[model samples]
Target chain A: MIPVCFILIILHAYVNKIAIYDSFVSGAKEGIITVFKIFPTLLGLMLSVAILRESGALNFISKIFLPLAKIIGYPCEAIPLTFMRLVSSSASTSLILDIFKNHGPDSFIGRFVSIMMSCTETIFYTISVYFMSVKITKIRYTLAGALISNFFGIISSLIITKIFFHY
Target chain B: MLSYLWVSMILFGILFSAFSGNLSGITSAVINSSRESVEICLTMLGVLSVWAGMMKIAENSGLIKSLTKKIMPFLKFLFPKLDKESQSIKYIATNIIANMLGLNWAATPAGLKAMQELQKINIDKKIASREMCMFMILNMSSLQIISINIIAFRSQYKSQNPSETIGPGLIATSISTLSAIIFTKVFEKIYFKDGDQK
Candidate 1:
């Protein structure tokens, strides 16, 4: 898919008589600047997240939420995923694969994780990177809206999986 | 908001490690995580630059303009305040299209570019504009039509029908994107009433 996209883009650029090499170089420079701007923000966010994870704090919190998740009809196995999804994308993805391994990809829990992963974004990671890139520290209702939408997205994932997969 | 969240994570992590007798874990983590962050950034550097370069070609070739024209109505509905021909709209359209195509690594540069463009017209440099908030919200509520990675993982794990999740996944994301739109619109109406009165 990626290779195809590159070829198509180059083809279009060639057809349009664009200076592909110079354009790419300039754009790559902008990309580097962006990475430099967000590097500190990403480092800080990752440090805190790493500390939380390595300290077993994330596990403790997941345990605390496990029962509430069950009572609310969320799959118990997805407790860690629900929390990690907000903080980190890679972690939640690994959690999903774990579910698939343990419960089989065709199982209800596996299906739930797959659907949930598709619908939800890495909320904190994305919010920080995008806002920090623009130096917008005074965030307003963006957090609330993101959390609310994500909450509903998860709920809808639950409903869809249950109705379709008979979980 | 981020400050508080950052502080809480640090405090809770330290205290919890103390209670859990995992002080050494946090020690290694604190020392190592920053390095890990750098590693991740370096890895992203290549992918981001490639995508940004491609996006530049797309922009210079008038592809983005054509695509923006195609999605103008939808973009206008989401960001009503922005001029129809604004450059930010073009970036936003590119970002949304990249996201829908499941090109996440490609999406970030475009999204950041969109944010930068939006910031140009922003009144308060420190505070987020309504359009910025809306764009962020849209991003958070996933828009991918095909979760290729998830399907590949399922297939790797030998699911009977690896692609079967596509239907439910699409439905779930649509519902989420819909809710994101509704919530963003409501928040815009309440807080940004009468042209940035707040």
Candidate 2:
């Protein structure tokens, strides 16, 4: 799919007589600048998240929410990944890998985490970095809205996975 | 809001470790995680640069403009306050297309550029406009037709059918994206009743 898009883009550029190389160079430069612009926020966010993980704060929160998971028929083992989904994709990915490693990929919990991981975004990370780049200080209700939708994403993932996997 | 989240995470980490007698773990994490953050940025650097370059070629070829025109009515409904001829609309459309195709590496740069363009026309320099908020919500929800990463992960783990999750993932993501758009509009109505619309 990506290759098809790339080919179509190249064909379009050729047909339109566009200066593809120079445009690419300029855009690449802008991309580098954007990375640098958001680097500091990414650093601070990752560090805090690492501390949270290493300190077992996430586990503590997961434990606190165990009853809620039980009520919804969600796997207790997958709770950490769902909690981490809000903060860091890398952390959640690692947790998903761990779940797959421990329970095997074909297991119900394994499939559930894989589906859930793809359904949601790293909300806090995206919000901070995106807003920081544009220098938007007052976010208003964006956070609340994103979090509420994320809640739906999580719930729907569980329900959908349960219905499909039937475990 | 971000500041509060950042500080609370750090505080909770410190306080929890102290109570659990694992302060040393936090110390090591603070040092090692900073390096991990740099590594993550470096990985993103390669992907973003390549995809951003491709996006530029697309823009130069007028693909983005044409795509924006095709989706203009939907964009108009979503961003009612934005001008019909705004350049940000093109960028937003490009970002959405990239995201839908599971080209997130390409999507971030366009998304950032779109936000920058939106910022240019913003009445208040520091505060986000309604359109900006709506765009961010859409980007965050990210309705995916194909979740390439998950498929790759499943295949790597030797799933019998790695693509099995695609159907469920699409349904779940669509629901989430719709809910996000609705919640954004609802919040705007409830919270910004008397504020400047533009």
Candidate 3:
């Protein structure tokens, strides 16, 4: 996918008589600057997320949601992934791997988790990185809107997986 | 908002650890994760630079501009307040397209670029504009048509059909993206005073 896109872009630049190398060099410079800008935000986000997970606070919160998840038809085993999905992608991915190991990939829970993980984004991570890029502190209703959409995504994931896998 | 959340997370983590007798776990996590974050950023630097470089070539070659023209109506509907000629529109269109193509690395730089452009037009630098919120919501809804990573993971785990989740994944993500658009518009109406009303 990436190679094809790069080939097409380079071809177009060549055809248009653009200084592809210089343009790339400058853009790469800007990209490095962006990484520096976002570095602190990433550090801060990872610290808090890791601390929460290690201290068992994340599991405590996930436990609290277990009953509600059951009532809503969300698999209990997925509560951890669903909770962590909002904050950290890497953590949630490991959780999914753990689930697959425990339940086997062909099991209902495994397929359900696979679908859920694919359909949801790590909202907090993306928000902090993007907002910090512009130094915006007062994010206002962005969190609210994101959570609303995330709720719908989880619900729809559950329904769709059920319809297709019938598990 | 981030400040409060960050503080709360740290505070709750420490307090919970102390009570749970897991203070040592927190210590290691803090040290390990800080290092891990830097490692992740180093990896991201390479990916971001390549994507940004390729994107620049695409931009200079008028590829992104032409693509933006194709999606202008959709972009306009989502961001009615933004001017058609604004640079952010081009970046926003690129971000969305890259995301739909499952080009995760390409999407972030474009998204960050779009945010920077949006911040330029924002009357208040500290507060997020409506368009910024809408953009973030759309991104968080996960609009990709195929999840290549998940398929690979399924295959690694030896699922009978690794790609079986594709159909359901696409359906679920489309539903989420659609709902994200609707809810964002609804929130805009309720929270931001309409232009006509004023």
Candidate 4:
């Protein structure tokens, strides 16, 4: 997919008599600057996430959501992955792997986490990185909207998993 | 808002660790996390530079303009405040297209560029504009036509049918994306309405 797009872009640029090399260099420079701009924000978020994880605060928070998971018929073990999914994809993927190791990928918990992971994103990470690039500190209702959408995603994942993966 | 979240995360993390007598754990986490952040930035540097360059070539070729023109009406409605011919729309469209293609690595650079363009037009430099908020929401709840990573993981785990989750994944993501759009529009109406009334 990427190769196709790259080839098409280069072909189109050549046909249009565009100065591809110079444009690429300039854009690459912009990309570097953007990385620099968001570095601090990323650092802060990662630090907090690390601390939250090591301190067991994340587990505690997930425990609070246990009743909700129970009501929805989700496995208690998968709660951490759902919460971590909002924070970091890599972290959630590791947690999902752990669940798979213990419960088998075809089990209810494994399928649930798989669908949940695929359906949502690392919300806070994306928001901070994108907004920080723009130097926008006040995000308005973006957080609320993203979280609500994620909630719907989680609910839908649970319902769909039950309907499709019923054993 | 971000500041509040950051502060609370740090503060609560410290307090919780202190109360639980896990100060040693928190200390190591803080140290390790900074290193991991640098690693992440380095990885992003490579991906972003390459994709940004490609997008620039596309932009210079006028491909972005043509693409933006094709999607102008929908773009205009979604971002009424942005100028029709602005460079931001092109970046935004590129980001959306990459996201739809499930090319997350390619999407990030375009998303960042789009945000930068949006920031250029921002009346208040520190505050997010309505369009910016909407764009962020859309990006966060990006609808995936195919979740490549999940399929790979499922196959690795030896699932009988690795692709079985694709249908359910698509349906869930679509609902999430639709909800994101609706919530953004609803918030825009409620929040921006007061500004118009004034």
Candidate 5:
């Protein structure tokens, strides 16, 4: 951490090229334009997300994982970890935070789900964005691999937590 | 190192910009407004450095090596075309572990290196080779057994115990990982099977 701080400070001091700033401001302006270019998609994504949440798509989905949780001797809250994988981590973090607040952070559900969210990626979003950027239409195996990892994370979290802390 | 430097440089530029301009200005107008600028470089550098350093530590701990060895047989069955001694394979294992631990810091370098190595074996520059595509696929849907970032975030938010999510993390990520590999195998069978038929 100290080295990181020093390097950042020294770099800021020595590399303060005014011209670079000008160039940066100019580039930032253009980057902003490009962002606008993607605004509709971004907006659409946000709206879809809003719809998903408000319309109870999330609640409906979480229920789907409930049976799996019971069968595996894990808490049902693991569903959010599974659910959020398709969306953004920021959103998932918010969910995890909410869970922690309501259920006490130390509760099995809160901690396990929180850790699971941290460990995984936003698979659906990544696949959609990357493929869209590359103009690829295939919806192939991207989510599959992510799902495999999600399973490992969920089950392992349960086992690990039970053996170590919770149980 | 160079790229990390660039990202960091970019980050500082953005931060200082906060002081100079109206915070309410159109964000997009600014992106275009700042032409040929290199602000992103610094931010990227800082991010890359932290992650790379973490990755180096993971490697040094021998955890990566052992995990690779433990999973080698299974990985081999999944990616049969890859040589057992392939550096790309080793790198792929590292990347997966990084992904599992939610260590994007360790994962990205190994990912980039894996790509570079995969590129060497690829025939066409335009299209990703099969292995490259597969690696990308696995990475895209990576499972997490120990979401370190989530734990850190929780800890930051003052969760009395931050890393309390390990149990659930393992279960959720395992499902995703299993499904990913299984589907990849099916995809391989279909794609490669057709190739053989041709």
Candidate 6:
């Protein structure tokens, strides 16, 4: 990736000399400012997670899905992972790793949610991002569209599990 | 009415299951999760701060503006009605740039700003203008250069080869973006045919 970017850099410099230097630096600069501006959101997500883990809230939360989770062959604890996919995909990715380590990827939850991940768009987050940027007050329709897709994602996951893992 | 039906079915399922405990737990998790989002977003500070700086320097240095100029021809074909001087156009370009880098967080402001800009040119207040609609569609089905979410998911799951998903994601999102473009065009032509019947 680095080599490719550098090559693009060199090529741009050769042809669009001024653009190459200016935009690259400016884009990187904006990236820096954005990072600082959003610092609180990142900190809040991590700290809340730490509290959940320490408070046993994670397990308590998982218990809600226990009955249906068993029927679907998923671990109830995977529920938090599902929500985590919204806040931070990386964190959810780590959670997926733990699930595999704790129960193996072959387990119901891993395979099920994995497929759901592929099918569903990040609904609420996308809306919030757009809202914040555009400062739009209305979000009803967008939310509806995303939630509706969530059903599609759930169905797709179930189908995927049946095709890939059912005995 | 149709939406009403959908909402009712969901509510009925929730009530009938009486697994309120399960739901309550899920709700709490969701609440808890929402609360934690700030920290996780913050934890990414180290990496994003540098990248954001790089992006800003590129902007201040005129990298982004030039790129927008370069892409203007192609963008014109995509959104002809948009005025070049409009803030919406600038926002759209910036948002798209952020998206291309998989910087969804940064893209939000650009996207929102674009919408506000679009509102200025809205015609009869009947429905969304073509440019506004297209912007929303493109933003929603954005073709990402790197799907940070997917990469993160791969990491969380502890795959021996987490990066393998990159190829598949690129292909999948490419298809989705193309589809979004095609669909938007079709919907517009079908729904907003320009001239009145003879």
Between 3 and 5, whose DockQ is larger?
Answer: 3
Q: DockQ of candidates 1 onward, in order?
A: 0.82, 0.78, 0.81, 0.75, 0.12, 0.16
What's the candidate order when arranged by decreasing lDDT? 1, 3, 2, 4, 5, 6
True contacts kept of each: 0.84, 0.77, 0.80, 0.81, 0.24, 0.16
On residues A15-85, what C-alpha lDDT tens digit does candidate 1 reach at each position? 99989999999988888887888899999999998898898887788888887787878888888888899
Tens digits of per-residue lDDT, candidate 5, B1-198, equal: 212322443344344345445233324423432321233334434555555544444344444566799889877876778888787888789887666655564465566656667666755544545565567667765555555566666776677867545555555555555666666777677766655411
Question: Which tens-of-lDDT digit does each residue in B44-143 have in candidate 2?
Answer: 8887888888999999889989988998988888998778788898889999888888888888998898899999988888888888899988888856
After superposition, candidate 1 runs with Cα above 4 Å error: none
lDDT of model 4 at position A148:
93
Winner on DockQ (1 vs 4): 1
Cα displacement (Å) at residue B82, model 6: 1.1
lDDT by residue (tens digit), candidate 6, A1-167: 43454454455455554555555455555545555554443343344443334344444556776887778655466677765654445566677677767764445665555555554455434544444343344432334334443444455456555655553
Q: What is the lDDT of residue A88 in candidate 3?
A: 95
Query: Which model is ahead, 4 or 6, in terms of TM-score?
Result: 4
Per-residue lDDT for A64-135 in model 5, tens only? 778876887877765765676556555676777777777867777766666555445665554444333333
Model 2 interface CAPRI class: medium
Among the candidates, what TM-score does chain A have in each? 0.93, 0.94, 0.94, 0.90, 0.75, 0.68
Candidate 5, after superposition: displacement of residue A19 in Å? 18
Better of 3 and 4 by lDDT: 3
Q: Which stretches of candidate 4 lie over 4 Å from their true place?
A: B194-198
Question: Which residue pairs overlap in candidate 3's backbone?
Answer: none
lDDT of all predictions: 0.89, 0.87, 0.89, 0.86, 0.56, 0.55
Put down candidate 3 lDDT per residue, A1-167, tens digits, no spaces.
Answer: 77889889999899999999998988888888888889999999999999999999988988898888888788898887888999998998899889888997778888888888777898989989999889899887788777877788788888888888776
Clash counts for all predictions: 0, 0, 0, 0, 92, 64
- How would you class the docking of model 6? incorrect
Model 1, residue B7: what's the lDDT?
A: 96
lDDT of 1 by residue, B79-108 (tens): 988898888999999999999999998899
TM-score of model 2 (CA atoms): 0.96
